[model samples]
Target: MTDPLLTETREDEKTAAWWRQAAVYQIYPRSFADANGDGLGDIPGIVSRVDYLAQLGIDAVWLSPFYPSALADGGYDVADYRDVDPRLGTLEDFDAMVAALHERGIRVVVDIVPNHTSDLHEWFQEALAAGRGSDARERYIFRDGEGPDGAEPPTDWGAAFGGPAWERVEDGQWYLHSFATEQPDLNWDHPEVRADFLKTLRFWSDRGVDGFRIDVAHMLTKDLTEPLPSRAELELLDRSSGRHPLADRDEVHEIYAEWRKVFNEYDPPRTAVAEAWVETPERRAKYASAEGLGQAFNFDLLVADFDADQFLRIIADNLEQARATGSSTTWVLSNHDVTRHATRYGLAPLAGRPVKQGVEWVAAGGPEDELDRARGARRANAATLLLLGLPGSTYLYQGEELGLHEVAAISAEQRQDPSFFRGASFDGLGRDGCRVPLPWTASGSSFGFGADGAHLPQPAWFAEHAVDVEAADPSSTLSLYRDALRLRHLLQAEEALVWTDTGRADVLRFARPNGWEIVTNFGEEPFDLAADAANVVLSSLALDGQLLPGEATAWIAPA
Candidate 1:
């Protein structure tokens, strides 16, 4: 029987040693740390805290966009590929950070926004100046048609941010921007464009960065004929233009294959983890084939509502796909771009289960307060173990280990992302709630996040969630995260096989081949096992059979 994942597998399998056993920690740099006492985070800040990250038991760190840009799209819009943003720091600061991180055996992966460039980027500006009459016009797709009443978009495609996908250029011609108008999609079909991108890749690789996490990897190539539509989405195609937009483009794979070659040329093993959001498993696999990407994010698991069937299907599908093509799949639940998993599952401090054994904060009183905090820590601990138990690459967003929930109050004025301005509707407004600055103190309201007169306002009650307080308390969420990550490393050292057994869907279970069986009751109610008196290695619950609420997980070994 033919495997479903293989678009085409070659004899040579590209290997990146750092990735296999890696526990990649994704840092949205803007919120990670601010060096220079500036409210905004910079490379110097990251450098200052290199040891903090190294201690997290992570093999690598994927830093989101530090490139020079207008910040229209929160640094996704690239103004310069070779230069570090002045606001971020000088290029030397980056080199220093990389060297410091290397000393601690932590590989650094930077974000590469290849699909599009900021309107302020030299290339985009040049393309605009060249206009409809020049060849540069081919750099981006241009169409001529009267929109609604000669003013609305010609198609019904909406922007991922929340507005029309097409923007009328100064020249009076409509240009396609699946995201913000400031972020014009690049034409990968152009030979010059491809050459420029390769050069950019080379530039970064020469700078000694370990690898790149290609942003919106699937959106690089688009269907020029039928632009994306703008309206309420009924089908997947309705949401995205009927055109493939980016994935499975022959040209795209070809370009990616060349990028693979570039990475191979580096001295040490380097990688390129593609952020491809293709819905179909087949399409996702094609991007991860030996000739295409090193690994692609399996986002199907991220959006999957908590359920046994969905969780099992996700693992099985990805495992089948990756193994077929001899490629790796990236498993993750939350990122800076979406609602945090804890928040998504409605794990808010609401009135439901017993308050004492719940994740709610109450006035410091009897053992009930201690029990509440303990339960919250356990919920976070089990969830982390569950995600880490899955096979293939896993991405842990910053502060996720702290079990951070989505902050509720982010007024329109506080919103800084450009995606929000583009989309008229706030459905899936680029995850600002989860991307807010990290909490690091328990003394003041700002959580020691900023000095007085900072650019970004600190959220109210920030101090309550600071790392200092959590670090001091052994049972705090911070300690739980550190312990869980350390546990994953230990499991790997024991030669555990993180493989998938497609026997049950509703019951999310995995084993080490060695007696360890990790299982989760993704659904409500207790699940009895075939084995009698299983050795419960770890559980989200107490000895008493109280089913820990949503996403409750446990680890066991057959007696």
Candidate 2:
């Protein structure tokens, strides 16, 4: 039997190291909740919902970009970094929201978009008026156009959103955007840019922000050499140690190291994570180092298939990364930027490969018409247990706990993602389906999201997953999440995890050193628990007598 004193010590240690193994919930501001009936979620709404989050058993809340923005890229294009957007709330409202969350013992992580600023930002506006080569222009990445008359873009790089990364100016020069035309990439080499971001970091930290998630962390510090490499050459650069002309430049760490110093100024030293999309483990480790942001997202599981081999491979690689960085790795399945895993799991693999589920499928009545949602939700529910049972942090996008799926379809005219309208390149891509407003009740113009309507439409089927509807049902996904989380606190006490061989195809079984046995059946048949599996602590789905259903997970008490 475990001693009370030992258990207490473990609890104390867990408190001090919460960020390492936190269950962070991501809130996409516009869709989470709404107050003032403005058709958009506001800070007051979040303040009102703090109790809900606290009850959900999350360690922290990751609020997506809510700073002053033009909504060009769903609030990622920041016009102001230090204050809340007027549409979302006033700074005073933000303070109350933070206060409410902290009162519930929940930490707050705000998004920090340092790579670029909205074109409407004061500095960017001044750059346009200051003319080329001026100090204001130097604050951004402006280059002389290529060719004789200076009419062509400076580089052949494509913007992540769609078209050319460089946009020509009225002054016969070109400025690098790397995103929407309304957003201009800032020059990290500029002292002013570096100094201003430090100020922004402290500004939020002073306002009780517990952490920052650096947006596009790998794309800062461009190699401003003449004759920029083509996109093909940029791909080749990833294989070499040489700095690419565009992204993942080595000098970017200098910026993070400086930010780390600022992060250390707080009482507990505010924490941070990088949204770096780097591929190699060694490269990702640099961003996740303690001297830098302390953590970088391990996104392998985000796009991995449901197959056991793929999941095990991703988990192994991420755990290895955690060992190398001396920080717990992060796991995530769905977010505002990607298709909800609920919908993704519904579709069959395309020719034995991971299927790409996009706006096209979501628009065509979703998988409801051509796929089995039961299989999808069953697998997703099991994955949740698999994730929480692991040894690191698990981030959950809002609404997944209720087993919410993507909206059936979004009309083209109502679609608002920048990718939707940017170009045909993104024609099949747009994140609106995943960003649709959440359903809080079974009935309402916006399903209790607000008094009137939601910014993004929620489908009628959303009523089936509404909080009020599911909260009353014992077998509902909401109850499963609530129970699983309550048990996770007890089960996660033992950090070390060992993979157990089940000697079966498409099955995964792992055990915490001192906790329950986690068994997941991805195979086609039900799995019978061994005789030692005497007590069942939690099941992701209903068990068929002594057999764990296919596409299900069971946590049997330690034998």
Candidate 3:
């Protein structure tokens, strides 16, 4: 029989070790749904939405840092890794939420912030009070200043967001903070620091968390030498050859190797994906290697243009590198950190590449008039379909299914990201645009986010893409995602990709091992698909009688 269209059922076959070849939906808890009237999304809000997640056919849900925090760096500044933030929920609430997801046959992957801790964390507080050269201060990367009276930072190092990476203490010492000053980098060389993270892993694993998304997986260990490497040396270090003094050092893999031991001790073997930002695919695969975390995020598609050559090369390299490490590739397009792809694809081209426009582009009141929003939407839809049809795991960020765009209209006074205030060269426009509260329904000031209000403001136009509105339209992006994900569930066992030449530079065509073929048209001209309508499986845009529309993607079954 021809491959039957799959249904969104709780199939035991699609789990795929509960990680590999899985569809994991990322829920930015603060903006996903709000249960209480406190104007913020919480665990209870997520608990209430388990049914929706199961309906979405995702194998797991990766909840971004929900631990106790000061809201610095959007919960990445974790004060307590062992417990849930009171604003979000309590320990019991967390357990209940985990249980709910498990009951629905959905796994939970928590965000683990091992690279740093909140300045308000107990360890950091102790480091502050313990004075310079004290045992408590050793818990973090602290050093004496370089210049007169210690006015200068330890070295010429700069922060990930902006400014000096080191923060001066009341004492003469300075502590390193790769990101915001509120987040102090931990001393991974410290035994207790290493042991504490092991305890953290066990704490969540014991609570039934199936996996973890390691924050800054490659930045955990640093060279931390006296008279640290100069900014030029650090910046000029060849990423292809030697270890980096600040990020992606060789010693970091030792930390992850230890982590793999703990992950292996679990029943089904808890899985983890490294959020490493290394450039080379081989280096990126190291984070996902057998000795390290089992998977690493492949972000090649995120920054690339909607061109076929770029997509094909990235897909081929990603699969090859990931396979070499005996790990599955983790693919993503947009997340809480960047601008939504629908909006990103709408921007004007720069230097023959997709302009590196992020939330900042939107924040600056970008060229909305010149943006081909329709074209962007088409490309994004096609891209997502292509991503879903690939051989490995796919991560779906919240609001993408509803075809959400980056909301630049947000007022500056209401913006909350640290990058906005820090003026960091990295994602300088701030990530608040992409992190806006999701609209579940078209009604209410908060658009069904909660009873009272949302922490971040939702624009009025958000109503057009509300879940309730899209749920009624079969042609909507929401319906397209629902159908695509369900159909993908049946292809969990297929893992090989064989490229098929379409005789066009603008067309990307590939065939899965299971006789299912996928084709994407990125050119201005539409391409005629050889498959008949009876053999068509799914498509981003409805086929015009066997002709795949421009800026669209389609799946066809074997004749």
Candidate 4:
């Protein structure tokens, strides 16, 4: 019996690096499978699931931050960079998990939060204990208040989460924090700060970790001498022509360049990917240049509307930038930070804003304007097919294979995201909707995420999309992913994508070198396939005869 989902192209023996064509899975450790009866997922829980990941056909797993912290920002606030939080596991547990992943041919990439550290970090604690002018205070961005008697904040910069960026201590000195007040920004200008991160990087690299995913990579260097920009100015700054005073500074590249030397010291040469939120493709390219971090996430595709023209423009622009920098383009649909693509696709498109910026706006839409779940699922499946066919490494957030949508109804009291607590100025509802634990079993406490209740409440609907239920149904989204991934090697050919003219403005048709054609319909109506495209290998939705439905994508091979 031939599998309908499998492609005919044979796996190639190309000598390209693993990351260039790899399908990396992103795991938010706290929301993945939990092994112990504890409500939260742990390192051991991840180890127990290595077989599951291996079966899914992913080449690598990028674990979100698990370092010891107060969980002020979903573990992004790190108190200790060298060890796992006791709540998560010990250092020994981490090593064992890494060993388990490596044994299964899956590489490990851990998150490194270099821009800031938790207020409880020993360095920050010591800085507070020491006087304002002490060497201990130099590690972080702490300064005397600007006004008389040192009362006013040093700058007017606002926190990324919300409120003022500066927080005053008992001593009347103000400290800078781009995120939550509990997560203070580190002073990269200090030599000790650079040395400390180098040591931290080596600690993980020596433990055989494959790579690092840098958090807030562009905001590392800030010009303390300059006054902070106004909120309006800051919002405009991301798109403005000038360099930002607090982000994407020219000096930030120097830090990565130095780190590149550390990365090269390893045998296969460890790599780093930056999470830069710069405006233009040219600015993004600089972060992924030879002298800087090897790769930076290109999120234009993630935020673009579900239109053929928008998709083509973003794809072309990213490819062009990647080519100029000699960096592999990275494509991702969803992650822990934003609303899941499934839910995002369900909402009506916002006129003037990109999808990423319209989450709060979507949330504001009343229950009368509820999500079109069926449409969202179909579009998500098509999007994944489109993403996998693109010519670069791809990232899949956990549970996306299960077709999970954002649990938007999570109560405010149950929400854990720091941003939610910060108020409407920060666009409040928070990212908790997308970080709910994966539903493993159709019937179990917390759907088999653990014996105990999940850290974040899982909506009752999760039972229908549980792994066990999906695994039993061949037509489920999970099955589609498994089959698509098993045959993804067909997309590994190092050739440029050739656009095919479908004679319709609303349909996007492109072909790879292997005679594999991908057609996606963005119009409001079904599209009739050409005679040669009748041999369909995969379709996001069941076809209506030879017609491809709107918001659907299909992979077809030559007859």
Model 2 off-target regions past 4 Å? 1-14, 239-242, 350-360, 363-368, 424-427
Question: In model 2, what lDDT does residue 418 have?
Answer: 82
* TM-score, candidate number 3: 0.94
- Rank by lDDT, highest first: 3, 4, 2, 1
- TM-score of each model, in listed order: 0.83, 0.94, 0.94, 0.93
lDDT of 4 by residue, 1-559 (tens): 1111111222342322577768999999999988886899999999988998998889899999999989999999999999999999999999999999999989999999999999999999999999789899888988888777888787677787888899999888999999999999999999999998999989999999999999989889887675656667766765434366787888888899899899888877787889999877788888888677888998876666677898877777777677677778899889988768877777666354332323334342313156788887888888888878877789999999999988766776788988878863323567888899999998887999999889998979999999999999989999889878887777566635777778888888887766787888888699998574468888888788889889888888656
Name the candidate, 3 or 4, with the larger lDDT value: 3
Q: Which candidate, 3 or 4, has the higher TM-score?
A: 3
Question: Against the true structure, whose lDDT is highest?
Answer: 3
lDDT of 4 at 367: 32
Point out the worst 10-residue segment of candidate 2 by lDDT.
1-10
Worst 10-residue lDDT window for candidate 3 reads 1-10
**Clash pairs for candidate 4:** none
Model 4 worst lDDT window (10 residues):
1-10
Model 1 TM-score relative to the real fold: 0.83
Off by over 4 Å in 4: 1-16, 226-243, 352-368, 424-426
| CA lDDT for candidate 1 | 0.67
Clashes of 1: 18
Would you give me the overall lDDT of model 4?
A: 0.82
